[model samples]
Target chain A: MHVLILGAAGMVGQKLTTALIADGGLGDQALTRLSLVDVVEPPAPAAFSGAVDRVAADLSLPGTAEQVVASRPDVIFHLAAIVSGEAEADFDKGYRINLDGTRFLFDAIRLVGDGYRPRIVFTSSIAVFGAPFPDLIPDEYFTTPLTSYGTQKAIGELLLSDYTRRGFFDGVAIRLPTICVRPGKPNKAASGFFSNIIREPLSGHEAVLPVAEDVRHWFASPRAAVSFLKHAATLDSDRIGPRRAISLPGLSCTVSDEIASLRRIGGEAVVARIRREPDPTIGRIVAGWPTNFNARRAAELGFVAETRFEEIIEAHIEDELGGRFVS
Target chain B: MHVLILGAAGMVGQKLTTALIADGGLGDQALTRLSLVDVVEPPAPAAFSGAVDRVAADLSLPGTAEQVVASRPDVIFHLAAIVSGEAEADFDKGYRINLDGTRFLFDAIRLVGDGYRPRIVFTSSIAVFGAPFPDLIPDEYFTTPLTSYGTQKAIGELLLSDYTRRGFFDGVAIRLPTICVRPGKPNKAASGFFSNIIREPLSGHEAVLPVAEDVRHWFASPRAAVSFLKHAATLDSDRIGPRRAISLPGLSCTVSDEIASLRRIGGEAVVARIRREPDPTIGRIVAGWPTNFNARRAAELGFVAETRFEEIIEAHIEDELGGRFVS
Candidate 1:
């Protein structure tokens, strides 16, 4: 089986590559070839016997989509996107890369014809929903995206579903919850505090809390995200029906919950590293984000996630910190 | 006030033009110029003193959008699109015209940046929805369109919402229900029978009903649709909030209800003109369409529609049949 990973240089992409290689296959099929694509060249997999094609390419460029799909990978993980902050800041660039790039890829695949259909797993985001929603948003709730990035993702989801229905490809778009305890250097993103407050404190470093303790949000670990993508790629298309965008199950929790989880695992010294600093700009932006979801459809479809924020943190420690953190 | 109608040659376009000319303005502003565009040249409205620029243009072409928006009409009614049947048959043309054309127009308006924000009323369709929904689909029900036309329109809605939120344009996407008693020659579209049944019978002609009488669907009159476009243009944007697309209020009734209404409006002689020839293909297509909608948001926002099928038939008689039928 051949697999392609777009945006293969990003955090989730790198981890997914490692996971796919470690497993030696996907969905019970032996991996014979792997194609990795990103704006920047993806690093070669460490210990894969498969034919590896690591290339740097921009999907928005006219012929780039055609070039990438020329190999006709059996499975495609489309994770490429300009992050929310960058997309919102640079409107034209965001639409160009996120919207136009996605269309380019989809069109290229469709034009290939001759039954070169692949299992396309697209990474959508919960940002596709806006505020003024119920506490637990159901699967059938409208995707009224408030951000340009969300809009582009929503459009991609629509295109993917349509293309799939037209029999051009078998595609599934998974709307991921924000990954908690993200293993990386803390960034200045509004939602960065969700991960920063947890990761920094656990590592015995100071981190600022931007929102209130009661401010709740849905989350899953990066590991869980990778698993969702894999499950989506392999799931029976019959079960997905016409609506290909699945709202994945998530762990709903608040800042207080994160702190409690940290205290329980990392001790009081780690918990004390978190300093309260409320920034209204981040507060306002975060306020408009959906905090919870029923995710009943995904649950019924056999998709799962970390049940608690504690599990998310433990996963982070085991995966990123080698099962240890600073006292 | 200067107004532009993108598809001024089509049925709804023509009606909106006549209505605009009859009223002499939109949103209480005196009309100065009317810019009409379509693939075919839009016929000039009768008895209008205002300046008229009617051009035959294809919006899918790159430079056309910029050229049309150069004049920058105060209110732009984007009503151009290939019908569902055509879009479904030709996938490339559908995306090119419906998706690319929309983006080009939006970008053109955005690039004319000098604080030139116009009220853009985009005419979306109920095809943006698919089956497997609740009997009374709410305003917030997810849009998982089952057709390529629906997919393109749904994508357009997302772009309009995002662009509006970004302050690129003040846009509103109104999802119009099937326009019943559509005043046109009988066409072979799956949905065409809905209009043909009522229209042909009233015009002293036999029409084929391709589905069971129990098959229900949503509808509104062409006049109501015109009013919807007008009302959407003038609505206070604050009431719309961030979700720019609205599932407009529609009268939901079954084919039986339609026949009963037709009998009442056009008498027994006209109802006898209906021939039952159940085509399984059209039946399968129509079965997947949504039948009912709460449309509470549209109602709350002061957008109204016929409550009964009888009223819809009467509307047809008044608007299309010159207040008389084959009775």
Candidate 2:
């Protein structure tokens, strides 16, 4: 089987590539070729025996998407997007890259008429649901995104469903929860604090907690996110029906819960590295994000996530820190 | 006040134009100018002292949207779109006119900058909602549109909310229910039969009912639709907040209810003109449409509609049949 990964330079994309190479296949077929594309040139998987092509390309540019789809990979993982903060700050850049880029890719795939339909796994986010949400948002709740990035993702979901419905392709959008204990430096995303508090403290470094302890949100592990993408690519499209997007199952927790998980895994000394700094801007932005979801459809569809924040912490230690904290 | 109607040549557009002319203004402002545009040249509203410009234009084309926004009408009624059947049959045309056209107009308004934000009342449709609904779908139900027309409208709603949030435009999308007793010839829309049965019978002609009598659906009158647009335009943008689109309150009833109302309004002789010819294709399409909605938000905001099918039929008679129908 041939596989294509867009935004293959990103952390999740790199991890997904590693996992795919390790498994030596996707679904029931062996991986014979892998095509990776990103705005920056993506690295080739060192151990993979497959024919690997790494190319640097921007999807929003004319004909770039066409070049990416020219290979006609059996499955395409579209994870390219501008992070939330950057998108909100630069409106034109956000729309051009996040919205137009995704549309360009979808249109290019559609224009490849001769039934060259590939399984498309799109990475969406919980940002699609804004504030004033119910205690636990259901699978069928309305999407009223507060940010431009969320709006772009919501539009992408709409286009994916429509394109799939029109027989252009088989697509599934997995609306991932914020990946807790994200194994990287803090990013500009408003939700960065969700991971910063856990990742930094565990690394024996100071991390600012922007919101209140009681402020809750949804989460999953990076491991689970990668798994969601793999399962999504191979899942029976017939079972998904016309609503091509699904909110993946996630753990519902608060800052207090993360601290508790940190204490459990890294002890009080490590947890003490978290600094309490009430940044109202970040608090206000994060406040509008969805905290919990009843992703019943995804649960039934066999997409699982870390059941506890403690497990998320453990996964981070094992995967990112080699089963050891800086402490 | 300057008012611009994007599809002034269509039935609902023409009616809205006539209503605006009759009232001599929108809200409390006297009419100073009326800009009417459509693919076909729109008719000038007769005897109006206000400056009127009727132009034939396609919004999807380059420079057209900019020209329209150049006038910078105080209230712009965006009512242009290909009907459902046509959009589904011709995908490219649908995306070009419905999606691209709407976006171009919005972009043009935004680029005009100089803090020019007009009240944009976009006419969305109930097609935005798909089937497998509750007895009464709530205002916040997920939008999984079952048709290309619906998909385009849903995307438009997303853009409208995002643009409004960014202060690009003060926009409101009113998701109109099927306009029951729609005046004029039967179009290719699957729901066309809903109006055809009532409209043709009242006009002393035979009408085909292409579905079971129990097929329930939501509806409103053309008069109510015009009122919704007027209200949407004048309603305080502050009250709308970020969620700019709303499901308008509408009467929900079955085909039998419509026939009963038709009988009452047009007498037994006219009702007898209704012929039952169940077209399975149309039936399948109509089945996937939302039958009822808990449009509590719209009602709370003072947007009203007919409570009974009989009143809706009576509205058709008074508004379209010159207050009389053939016996």
Candidate 3:
């Protein structure tokens, strides 16, 4: 199977690339070739003994989607999107890259017209659900996104379902939860604290807790996200039926639970590194986010996630911390 | 107040234009100027003594949206769209006109830049919902459109909400039910039978009933649709909160109800013009349409519709048949 990964230079994309290369295949088909695309040229895999092509091209540009899709890989992982903050800040840039880019890619495949139907795995976000949500958002809750990035993702989901219904391509959109222990420097995202408090403290650095300890949010690990992408790629499209968007399973827990997990893993010293600094702006923002989901449809389809935060922290320790923590 | 109607030549648009002229205003503001646009130049109102401008402009064309919005009409009714059947058949044309055209119009308003926030009444359709619907689809039901037209309208709804949230404009998307007792000749739309059965018989002609009497569907009169548009225009945006798309209230009844109403209105002689011919192709197509909606939100917001089929037929008789039907 030939694989193409868009946004291959990003964090999730890079992890997915490494995982796919190590697995040496997707499902039953052997990986014979790989194509990587992003705004920045992605690194070619060193370990993989297969044909690899890398390209640095902005998808928003005219004909860029067509050029990238010319090879028509068997599996396409579309993870490229402007994050919520940036998209909210620069509306035009966000829509151009996220909405127009995704549409361009879909249209490119459609214009191919030679019965070349590839399995596409698109990464949607929990941001699609705004404030005033049910305690556990069901598989059928309405999507009224408050942010531009969320709107773009929701639009992509609609298009994905429509194109799939039209037999243009088989597609699945998985709405991923916030990735805990994100294995990178903290960014400006409002939800960044969820990862920072865990990742920074375990690395012997102080991290600010923007919201209250009781504030809850949904979470999954980087490894789980990659697994979801793989699972969605190989699953029977008929099982998904018409609604192509699926809210994936994630561990729903309060900030207290995360702290407890950290304390258990790296002792009290590591937990003490989390500073008490309440920012109401971030608090209000995080308060509107979805804390839990039924995710019944995705679960029924065999998609799984860690039920306990301890597992998530352990994965981070083993994968990012090289099996050791600050304590 | 200046009002711009993008599809002023269509049936509902013409009715709305006439009603606005007759009312001499929308709500408290006096109608000072009226601008009409469509693929074909709309006819100027002969009775109204107001500044009337007519233009034959395609919104999908570059610079056309900018030119149309240059006047900055205080109330803009964006009713332009390619119908469902055409959109499903021609993918590129549908996206270009329905999706790109709407975006261009929105961006043009955003570009106006000097705090020009107009009240935009957009006409969405019930096509946004597909089969496997509950007995009564609620206001919060997720939109999973099966047709390309539905997909485009769904995208428009998302964009409308996002742009409204950003304070670029005050927008309301009214998802109109199938307009029953249509005045014109029968068309190729699968749902045309709903109107054809009643309309053709009243016009002294035979009408075909292609489905069983038990096939229930949602409906409203053209006059009710115009009223919904008017109500949506003058509504307090704050009351609407964040979600801008509304499933307008409509009468839900089976074909039996329609025939029974026709019998009471025009006697068995007029009903005898009906011909029973089952077209399985059309039956299957109509079977996939949404049968009902709760429409609680729209009702709460004071958007009313005819509850009885007799009232709907009376409306068509009063509005289109010169207060007389062939008996």
Candidate 4:
């Protein structure tokens, strides 16, 4: 099977690329070609016996999306987006890249009109749900995003559903929870602390706890996120019906719970590495985010995530630390 | 108050214009200047001393939206959109007019900068909701529009909320129920029959009921619709928070209830004028529509509608039929 991966340079994209290369295919088809794209040139996956093409281009630019879709890959993984903090700070750039860029790609595919309907797997975010949320957000709750990034993702979900309903393409939008134990340095995303608190401690470094321990949030492992994308590409569209977007299953926990899990996996020393540093700006931004969700629809559709915070930490250690932490 | 109506040539637009002219202004302000725009040149409201400019322009085209916003009307009634059947049949035109046009206008207003935020009352539709619905769809129900028209309106609502939240404009999207006892002749909208059975019969003409009598739907009068726009323009945005879209309250009843109300208003002779010639295509389309809504939010916000089907029919007689039916 031919495959295309947008945003292939990002952490999740790189991991997804490695996973696809290792599997030698997606679903039941053997990989014959792989096209990877990002604003920056993505690295070539090592040891993959396929026709690989890596290109550095912005999808929002004129004709760039057309260039990406020209290959007519069987499945397209759209993982490109500006992080929340950057999008919030730069309004024009945010709308241009997140909203207009996505639309450009969708339109390009639509214009390919020779009945070429590829399976599109879009990465949406739980940020689509803003504050004043119920204790447990249900699958059918209204989306009233507070941030521009969330708004763009929400719009993308709408477009995906509409385009799929119109027979332009078979698409699935997975609203991923905050990916915890993210194996990377802290980023500018408002939700970055959810990962930094764990990743930094495991690496024998101090990490600031921006919010109170009582502050709760939803999470999924990077492994689970990649799995969600893989499953989405091959999932039965008939079962999904016209509602193409689904809130993926996730584990709900608080900062205290994360600390407890970190201590359990990496001893008290690692947990002690976390420093209490109150950052009101991040707190206020995170406060408006949803902490839990009743993702019954996604669970019933066979999407899975880490059940416990400990498991999430363990997965990170195994994947990023070669089965061990600094301790 | 300087007011602008984007689709001043359409039925709702014209009615809203007339109402605004008669009221002397919106809210407590007196009429100063009026700007009316549409793809066709709008008729000037009569007996108004205010400066009026009616222009034929397509908002989706370059610079058209900028020109419209140049006047910087205090309140903008964005009522332009191709009807459902037409939008669904002509895909490009629908997105261009409904989605792109609305976005262009919003962007134009945003570029006006200098804190020039106007009260933008956008006319959304119940089409934003899809079928296989609960008995009463709640205020927080997810938007999973099944038609292209519905999709466009849903996207517009997203843009409206985002733009409003960013302080670019003070916007409110009112999801209007199907206007019953409509004054004009039937158009191509699948929901056209809802008005036809009542409108044609009251005008001493035969009308076709395209679906079973048990087919239920939500509705309001053209008068109520106009009131919705006016109230939306003056409603306190502070109370609305970040979620700018609202489902307006309306009377929910079945086709049988409508006919029963017709009998009450125009006697059995008028009810007899209704012909049962079922068109399955329209029936299928209508079947996928929401039957009812729990518009408690709108009700709490003081948006009122007919409580009884008889009152809805009476409203038609009083407003459109000169207080008497053809009989």
lDDT, candidates in the order shown: 0.91, 0.92, 0.92, 0.92
| TM-score per candidate, chains pooled | 0.98, 0.98, 0.98, 0.98
- Give the per-residue lDDT of model 4 (tens digit) for B1-327: 899999999999999989998999888889899999999999878889989999999998989999999988999999999999999899999999999999999999999999899999999999998878899999999999999999999999999998999899999999999998788877778899999999898899999988999999999999899999999999999988788999999999999999988887789999999999999988878988999999999998889998898888888888887887887
Model 1 chain A, TM-score vs. native: 0.98
Point out where model 2 deviates above 4 Å: none
Per-prediction DockQ: 0.94, 0.86, 0.94, 0.87
Tell me candidate 1's interface RMSD: 0.5
Residue pairs clashing in model 3 are none
Report clash pairs, candidate 2.
Answer: none
Q: What TM-score against the true chain A does chain A of each candidate get?
A: 0.98, 0.99, 0.98, 0.99
Per-residue lDDT of model 3, residues B4-93, tens digit only = 999999888888999999999999999999999999999887588889999999999989999999999999999999888788878889
- The complex in candidate 2 yields a DockQ of 0.86
What are the per-residue Cα lDDT tens digits for candidate 4 across A54-167? 999999898999999988999999999999999999999999999999999999999999999999999999999888989999999989898899999999999999899889
lDDT of 2 by residue, A1-327 (tens): 999999999989999999999999988999999998999999878798979999999999989999999989999999999899999999999999999999999999999999899999999999998889999999999999999999999999999999999999999999999987788887778888889888888788999988899999999999999999999999999999899999999999988998997888788899889999999888888989998999999999999998888899888999999888977
Indicate the TM-score of model 1: 0.98
Residue A21, candidate 4: Cα error in Å is 1.4
Candidate 1 chain A least-lDDT 10 residues:
A182-191
Extract clashing residue pairs from model 4: none
